[model samples]
Target chain A: MFDLKPYLEVQRQRVDASLKSYLGPEDASNSRVTQAMAYSVMAGGKRLRPILCIAGAQAVGGDHEAVTALACALEMVHTYSLIHDDLPAMDDDEKRRGKFTCHVQFDEATAILAGDALLTLAFEILATTASQCQAAEHPKWLRAIGKIASAAGCNGMIEGQMRDIAFEGTVISIEQLEALHGLKTGKLIQASVVSGGMVAGASEIQLQALGAYAAHIGLAFQVADDILNVTGDPERLGKATGTDQARGKNTYPLLIGLASSQHLAGQLVDKALNALAAFDKKADPLRAIARYVVERNR
Target chain B: MFDLKPYLEVQRQRVDASLKSYLGPEDASNSRVTQAMAYSVMAGGKRLRPILCIAGAQAVGGDHEAVTALACALEMVHTYSLIHDDLPAMDDDEKRRGKFTCHVQFDEATAILAGDALLTLAFEILATTASQCQAAEHPKWLRAIGKIASAAGCNGMIEGQMRDIAFEGTVISIEQLEALHGLKTGKLIQASVVSGGMVAGASEIQLQALGAYAAHIGLAFQVADDILNVTGDPERLGKATGTDQARGKNTYPLLIGLASSQHLAGQLVDKALNALAAFDKKADPLRAIARYVVERNR
Candidate 1:
């Protein structure tokens, strides 16, 4: 009976509103760099990570406001990553989310500054938000921020990106593909769920369970993305389809075959659901997310 | 006659030693991304910012170890900035500290990841360090991290870089130059001093004084660089002479004559010294740093 459409919409709205406030106004005294930052952050997207963060926080009885700053912080990091990814030196995409990429919309210099600004802003938000929270909760907030930072940084997603670039035009083993996906995409998603649980004061057992759920879903999400890239509609995906194959980039389907990829994705979804078995009925939303991860077309 | 050479050597060694330990071991389990990060971070530099951080902490009766994490964090940020600044899209410098820059040494992709990793590691260090600190000090630590984050991010140094890029080859007013330098260089230096004071539980007045001292010295440091780029020995400077002019970038010597630039730098050093007058004799090192800023040939 659970409908992901409405749930996703509500969460997206909440995250979007918060992000709008988090970016604030463009001051006249502000330089073009600041303005570029605002434009890039305000550019519309699904707000999946921030919404996941809020949902994760709420799932554990945490207050929305307690994690609001972190939600914004996560989005900033995500946006910065996207900006850098789109640079002429990287993926060099001219468009994202149906709009011009940061570097393309503004200049390359502005894009770099905007991305750097957003990354720094994320940490600032985490630090300031930690101070505003209760003394007992400060450590938890700090840990959450640390996890997010690491996931976005070199040891995690960025490293994965390096591997992806290096492996371009070459066939990668399934294990290598999994490792790349885990670092590139899984860490941030894991951080999103774990951060929420930390803020809500979830027990250690519960935290571990949530991490399992996140890991499974994170993998499932990537598999689904790979599937969509191969089969999804261009209008719905908001990006060019078949580019992954055309670019000779390794993907789940490429390494394991489409049927095997789908089977693997299903197994991940099952694992995600099983991980949530310990949670009370309140975790139903999370279960729905796991299912949606593999089932969604885009 | 206090000589900073020995102290500088000692501090650089300490920072270098700590950096090696902080980077952790390189292994198969450790991704190539992290290896690249270790390469860039372990690459040699003077460790001036970290030394300044430790000095700032010591000025307020805090042990260097108490601020070591922050010191490492500052160096990570500084290193990341340099890596990005040397990208083909940016300053495009092939050399730094007399060696091939990160992008030139490694692939551009690896270099980018290395920078990302270093920046992320900085926050992780702060977060983990803060968690290990006394509970009562958590708020202070978080605040310090937040200040550093803000200074590094969009509203600060990155924005300054954007303005600097935009104003290249264009005549900039002195006030505009001050604003740019303040954000680009002054903010991080200010954060270093303020963070040290915060860790030491300095009074609000003391914190303000420290900030003033750092700001003056920061500007003075840039002015000295401008002067040196024009006047210093090429061998000692370790880079091309008059490159600023070659690139058509504005500088203190370019805007106000060399004599005026020297006089202005002297005035700023005096202002920096005056700001430290509120502190007792413990502030001698800081005063010495201000003098060194003006007097150093390299």
Candidate 2:
């Protein structure tokens, strides 16, 4: 079995160091907004999306250094979403990743601006970073950036939140629930994986396989999230566990029961791993990630 | 001496027709969020940024079709800013463009999501549209996108917004207020003009001239806005007069009296016109726009 922990940590440390440079200064002038942005990012999550981007690139024999920018961009998008999702207008949460949420720490308007800034910064990073690449790769940069945008845009994650809001407290079909999760959490995860592959200059066959792998793993990650929401330790999870059920949220566990949700996550992981069969040991991280998604304590 | 009304109208109609297509469908599943996004964009405004983009490209001899994507992208960013700025947590405005604000028409959460969606869609349009361009233009696309992102990101509009919020009900000097508006409103306006120029592969000299022109017009536009807030007819202005005073918001008229403010606006316009000395009638739109900015009723 591959020891994925150290690999994840190594990338985590690297991203953490560079993310600050990309963020520029929290100067005395714009300190409040910059502080909120840095606070939210540095509060810490698994950095899962970025690590996935790196692994995907590695699996395709691509340069990890070249893909670092894309990985950071993905993480920024995830960070922005979390900040917005925790706002008084959305989930109304006061804490995130073991710290006061952006709105709670800074004022609400500052939080909103911080989220806006972070989201805008993601594209800025992608565009500027791509400029450093050879002229031949410019089209790929545009395509990759577009994919990231769509995954996070109206028809993707935002729409999923809209549907969730519309469907809250109601029993939704497995398909409806699946589709909702697929958009909310799954799409970005898929984007994270596929973005890495694209940066690595993936061939059509490799891209397809990566897509399949991403699709399966994305759902598994969400399913596991739902399960953790119900049963995981709040301390480890860095959030209260029962809010989903309390809010009558539409989730895999809520729709099909916790046991079934767990089983579904397992099945999805199996599919995710199978999709990577064509790759040799080079894809060990991808395989390990799928398993870890269902097995993570947090 | 150019008649800008007809020229502005022609581009407005073209952009309005295509803007809807960029927003995608108000699908039944995500109708609430999609509706909010559509409603916000469709609500009438000058579409100044988009027109600036088109004018910038035209002045540099670029293809209109190629730059239309960027034109729409600028509009979307503008729309998103308006939506967020009106939220209860931000400007807390009840109305905009003589209509109920997005939060008023569609709850705070939906409004928030709509703003986020619009922002994301801008990048999506840039990426996807740039994909259709010739390979040689790919780097230009990245540069253009990066410029847009920087103009709108934390160091730009959002940071400016942060300052505006912090400075509300507090006094600020002319220089401070100028710097604030320069970032808040001016950067994106500058980006709008420059993005079109970049798409057309502007020579460095032409780009610098456009920059100087944009800088002047941007400040002149804001100065005119401050004058109008205190003096213009309420109906023509769309929003109420003296709200800036009511809110203690800083403005040129407040800082330096209406007469001086108007004088400053004219001077800026003259400077903007002077910046175009190197270009011929190809920049007629740019010249006309500077005049219109300080002269328009609203």
Candidate 3:
């Protein structure tokens, strides 16, 4: 009964507006590089990560605007990951979100710098937010920033990326696939939820529950993505469909058959919902998010 | 004479030991990436940034130990930059500091992951330090981390790098060179000094002076590097000599003649020393560093 469409549309608009403000005006003097950055960042996409961050904060009875900077930061990290993942040295995809990837649209070097700039910008936004917050609130904001930093940095997503690249062209065990997804995809999503919780001043128990909710949904989201890549319409997806199998990439669909992947995704959604059981009806958005993760077409 | 060699040696040992302890064990389980991180981090460099940090702290009569984590974080950022710079898509250098580059020794993907890991670890160390510090000290540490994150992030070093790459094989003004070096090299070094000052609880006046001091010396440091790249002994320098020229990269020596570049470096060193005039004898180490910046053969 929870219609997420309207909520998603509103959240998307909020995230997009905030991102525009966060990126600031492009330097006319350095238009070439700055424009390239804006082109990719401002390009339309789902804005799912930042929306999740806003929703997560709201789920914990916190003001969404309070975590706006953190939400923008989460999106920046997500965008940077996509930019790098699409590079020739990595996944080598030419399109992302139905447009030419940063590297393809720009030169490889420009794309690299743009991605680097975006990554650095994420931390800068977080730092600026910490500084602007009330003195009493600085530590918690710093902690949230730290969580995002760790999730995006080497010990987490980057390491997972390495495992992914190394395991390509080779059959990977499901356990390894899970670990890879946990680091590459799960950590950032978990950070998004945890950041919202921190900003909202959620209790330790609530934060832990939110983390579990995020992890379950994060995995479910990836599984769904894998399924879509295998079965979704290329035109609708805005990216190449079935490219995962074509590239011999390890994914949930490859590890488990399509039917099994869908089933696993359902179980993950259930688990994610279970993790939120301790929260009141206020957490309906997060519950809806879990279901949406498995049901989203793109 | 202050006997900087011994001081440098002692600081190097301390940093190395702390870095090892901080990185934890080198086992294959959770440590493959950790070990790769340590391998590049511990492989050793001049540790100039950390030394500068310590000198900045000392100039303000702050406890050097308090700033040690910040110092290490600075070095981590520097190392990560180097690892990424040596990637095939970038500088394509096979050797660094006289040894095989990370990508050459390990696979390119591992090297990329290692760099990513180092960057993340730096933030983790800063965040953990901020969390553990006294309540009043937490903001100071967060500010220090912020300074670092900004220096290393977009609108700073990465922007400089974009310009550097774009300007390659093209005519550039001396001002452009300065801007490029200021962002690419000076920002991190400046952060090192400023973060150190922050850790030492420096007054506003002292922090501003320290920043000025760092800016002067950082520019001088790069000019000195340009000089060395063209004139220094190849064996002592470890990396290839005249790489800038080979790559058609713009540098001080190329922009201005060698003699003018040397003169500019000396002037900047003097400016660096002049910035510390307000400090008492505690600033002597910093003054010594300014002279060392230009006088060193390697």
Inter-residue clash pairs, candidate 1: A117-B154, A154-B117
- Higher-scoring candidate on lDDT, 2 or 3: 2
Question: Residue A207, candidate 2: how far off, in angstroms?
Answer: 1.0
Clashes of each: 2, 0, 1
Interface RMSD of 2: 0.7
**Pairs clashing in candidate 3?**
A154-B117
lDDT of 1 by residue, A1-298 (tens): 6777898898777777877777765555556777777787888776777767776776777746767778888888888888888887788899877778888887886787678778888888889888888899987887788788878877678877887888889998988989998988898988888888888788888889888989998999999999988998888767789989999989988888899889999999999999988787667778888888887853
- Report the lDDT tens digits of candidate 2 across residue range A73-95: 89899999999988988888899
Candidate number of the best lDDT? 2
Candidate 3, which segments miss by more than 4 Å at Cα? Answer: A25-30, B24-32
lDDT of 1 by residue, B104-194 (tens): 8777767766777788889988888888888998988999998999899876778777778878899898999999999888899898888
Stretches of model 2 off by over 4 angstroms after superposition: A24-30, B24-30
The CA root-mean-square deviation of candidate 3, after full C-alpha superposition on the true structure, stands at 2.0
- Per DockQ, the best of the predicted structures is 2
| Candidate 1 wrong stretches, greater than 4 Å | A25-30, B1-3, B24-32
TM-score of each: 0.96, 0.98, 0.95
B1-298 per-residue lDDT for model 2 (tens digits) = 7789999999898888889887655555446788889889998899999999999988887746868889999999999999999999889999998999999998999999999999999999999888998888888888999999999988899988988998999999999999999999999999999989999989989999999999999999999988989988889868899899998999998889988998999999999999989897889998999999988843
TM-score of chain A of 2: 0.96
User: If the candidates were sorted by their lDDT against the true structure, best first, what order would they fall in?
Assistant: 2, 3, 1
The residue-level lDDT of candidate 2 at B232 comes to: 87
Model 1 chain A weakest lDDT span, ten residues long: A22-31
For model 2 chain A, where is the 10-residue window of minimal lDDT?
A: A21-30
